[model samples]
Structures are given as C-alpha cells and as structure tokens.
Target: EITGLDDKDTVFRTVPSDDYQGRALARTLKEKGYDKVAVAYINNDYGTGLANAFKAEFEAQGGEIAGFAAHEDGKASYRSNLAELSSGGADTLVIFDYGDGTGLTILRQALENGFFEKFVGGDGMKSDAPINELGAENLATFVASSPVGEKSDSLDIFNDAYKAAGGDPDAIFVTTSYDAAFLLALAVEKAGGDKAGVSAALREISNGEGEAILPGEWEKAKKLIAAGTAIDYKGAAGDHNFDAAGDVPGTYALFEVGADGFEVMVEMK
Candidate 1:
C-alpha cells in the first residue's frame, strides 16, 4: 500500500545531511584555528538549515559567528551581503548556496571586498560549475564538502555498474539515484514484487538482517538475493540503512578548488 514509505520509515537525505556537514565543517575550521567566521546562505531550506547547523556547531566548538546573510532566489547581486560579511571581522567565510551563477556572484563580491582569507562551502557548491563560471584564479582559496566522489573503496563497484549501464559514474546524482533504485529493486524482489512485501522487507534490511553490500557488489547482492540470502546495501553515497531519524550516516569529502578542477582534501569520518 506504500503506507510504510511515509516520512517515518522512508529516508529523506540530501546526500550529505546539512546537520552533519555543518558540524564537520565547524570541526574542520576549528582544527584550522579560525576564531570568527561569517555565513552566507540562500534563503531556502537547503541554505538556512545548513547555516544554522554550522552556527550551532561552531558555537559549541567555541567559535564565534561573525555575521549571517541570506539571499533571495532570483537575486543576481550579492554585493551588499558580501560587504556585510567583509566588515563582520571574520577570517573565514562559509557559503551555503546552490548553482554556479549565484555562487560566482557572491564569491566575486567577497573577493573584491577582501573580507575573508578562506572561503568554505557546503555540498551545494561542490560542483565544477562554480570554478568554470568564476574562473579558477578567483576561486583559489575556496573549498567545499560533498557526499560524492571516490572517498571509499566501495565506490569502485558503483563506478563499474554505472559504466556498464552507460552512465557517468562520476556524476554525483547519478550514483546516488542508481543506488536508490537498486535498494528499491532489492526490496521489491525480496518481497516477491508485492508492494506490501517490499515495505516489510525494508525493515529487515534496515535492521541488519543480512550481509552488507558495498558499492560495486550489486551483482553479487542480486545473486545472493536470488539465492534467498539477505543483504544490506552500503551505497556509493554511504550506508543506505536509515537510522531512527530517517537519516543515513553518509561520507563526505572536503575539496579544494584548483585551476584545472577540484582536489579532495579530506574525508570526514
């Protein structure tokens, strides 16, 4: 009946959860010994939630939030907000926004003002498009964290599967969406293709009812499932098993923007 798939049993994750990312970022900045930081975010769920999370975590870590700025959607200019962040006495600036165009606009303004020495971004800015839009020279001091990439050994499997399926394995969304599809398919198959059965199967899978399937082991998982073996799918994004909060413990990598592309700086635990 698809009843169990409601907000309760069903998982709702944005690759890297804003809360986790925020905390991790705070920890990273603290490790780097930053005292004051400014936050600039989009006026949306993605941005606001992440900014709040970062602020809470940073404060808990004995860091101060120097300033906070939110930009409306469709707003092309971020000069005013950047000005505020610049004058906020922050050494580091955190950005929580999506889209290369907006990110470039904000970064350009921030750089022009000479407000921050380091710029950090959430998963929303973990794309090549930003560097492409702003030019690498302008993004030299920018960094980001995201749930995708080859941070884990398990990603090898997902990469092979994606290529076999004629897809680009490096595309963040592609691997995540593929893993979701595989999990759904496995559940359905275990439930004997019955929707009700699938719902029941999800609980079993979530509760450690089988061997964990790491990325690239989907074919092995399919065979095991066919052989009446239970399986737990550790996805390319991270472990697909959702906790009580309906959130999965995902992996994220800190990336530095370079002239050619982005390089992985650190993988968060």
Candidate 2:
C-alpha cells in the first residue's frame, strides 16, 4: 500500500514490497531450471499481482507457463482447480497465496492426489503447515523464495535482549518489529518529538548521515542527537536506509525443506 508514496512522508514496511517478492519467486523458478510451469493463485489482489509479475519475469527468462488458474481463498479443498492447473503437462507448479492455512491445504491435497511433485512458492509458504501436513521428506521437492537477512553481529545483541524481554527470537518479523520500533523512537527524538518532524528525521538518521549507531546504544544515540550529531542508527536488521521512494531494498533467498526443517538453498543476489 505504501508503494509510490515518494511525494508523501509515508514510510511503511516490515516486510518486502510485492514486486520484489515476485522477482524473488521468478528467481527461484529460474534457479530450479523448470522449463514448463503452471500457476495456482488465490483469487485476490495479492495473488493476481504476483501472478502477473511472475508470469512476465519467468517468460522473459525463457520459461513456459503451460497453465494458470485462480482458486478461492479459505475453501476446504481445491482439488478440481489443482487438477486443471497440473493437467497442462507442466513439470513445476507455482502456488501464490497466503499459504499458512488455505493454500497449504490445497498443496497437500494436490500432492496427495499426485498432481505434481515440484513447486515454487513465495514467503507465504514460510509457515510450518506445509511441512507439518506433507512431512519434510515429501516437501523436499518444494522450493520457496523469500526475504532472508545476511548474518549480522547486531542480531546477536538484539536476540539476547529479545529473549530477556520474553520475546521469541525465532518468531516471524521479530527482528523487523524491534528495528522499526527503535528506529521510529530514535527518529522522533531526533526530530524534536512530533509526528510533523519525524519524516525527515527518519531519513536523516538512517541513510548513512553521521556516526554509526549500533543496537543497544539508544542512550548514546540520544546524547549524540542532543549534541547535534546526525547519527545513523543501524539496527539488528542492518541498515534502515530508505531511498528516494521511502523504500528500503532487502535481500532474497531460496528456502527448501530438508530432513530437519527449512534450510537456505541459496541467497539470491
């Protein structure tokens, strides 16, 4: 929703934008080198946007989409649509949906019915439902494209504090929430304490302006701001440098289920 708000002072993101996510999916599809693909998307804006983006990129990369279908969300079953999607002789199927509950059921049902063995998906499939339902061995053929951060020393400090504060370090968006909250607070302080001043302050402190501020150094950060120091606040998730469009670029990776659990197959560049 916050995309293309470069003219305004709005900056909103805990996760990646949809366009990058589609590119991530396309990247994973190319990595697996599937010549023919089929798509099963949730009949919604999110799914449609991803479907179009993935279709364009995948085809541009010399891949063929043999079939495409959209299934309603929250349905008990999608066997009919799954069968149709897989009937085009495509070796790989890409399902685009919020997969925790609705899409997981469909994927498992498709697998149970022997619809297809290989799949390429997005961050929506980052949940445990797929593995829990299909088992890791069965899900080994599935590959996921999603955001994953590079290893950072700051994450250790934040994770330590997170555990102490009764927060689950393994939880989704834990790092993002922490980073955003602290960055907003720091920006507010630097902006002289008001929503009116926060927009510019956020950019001032985040985009490599002055001295680098690491995690757990908020007190020092405040002092530096008080001293008229334009300090850059690098959180546990690394830099929060919002660009001209108030969007921060993030990394992508391919995730696949292994014997134990999800493992990073490759960090996409």
Quote each prediction's TM-score. 0.85, 0.90
lDDT of 2 at 230: 81
Which lDDT tens digits does candidate 1 get at residues 1-269?
Answer: 12134654555442546777788888887877777989998888788888988899899999999898888866667777777777878878888987475766676677777767888988778777777767888777788877664445667777777688897665446656766676777777778788767656765654566888776565787788789877877667666666555556666768887655777777765
Specify the poorest-scoring 10-residue window by lDDT in model 1: 1-10
Task: Report the poorest 10 consecutive residues by lDDT, candidate 2.
Answer: 6-15
Give the candidate number with the greatest lDDT: 2
User: How far is each candidate from the true structure, as Cα RMSD in Å?
Assistant: 3.6, 2.2
Predicted candidate 2 versus true structure: per-residue lDDT over 1-269, tens digit per residue: 45776557666564567777786677666766777899888888788878888888888888888898887878787888887888899867888876587779878887888888788777777777788777887887888776655467777888888899997664455677777888888989998888888988888988877998877898999999999988987777667788666777766677888876678888765
Clashes of each: 2, 0
The models' CA-based lDDT, in order, is 0.73, 0.78
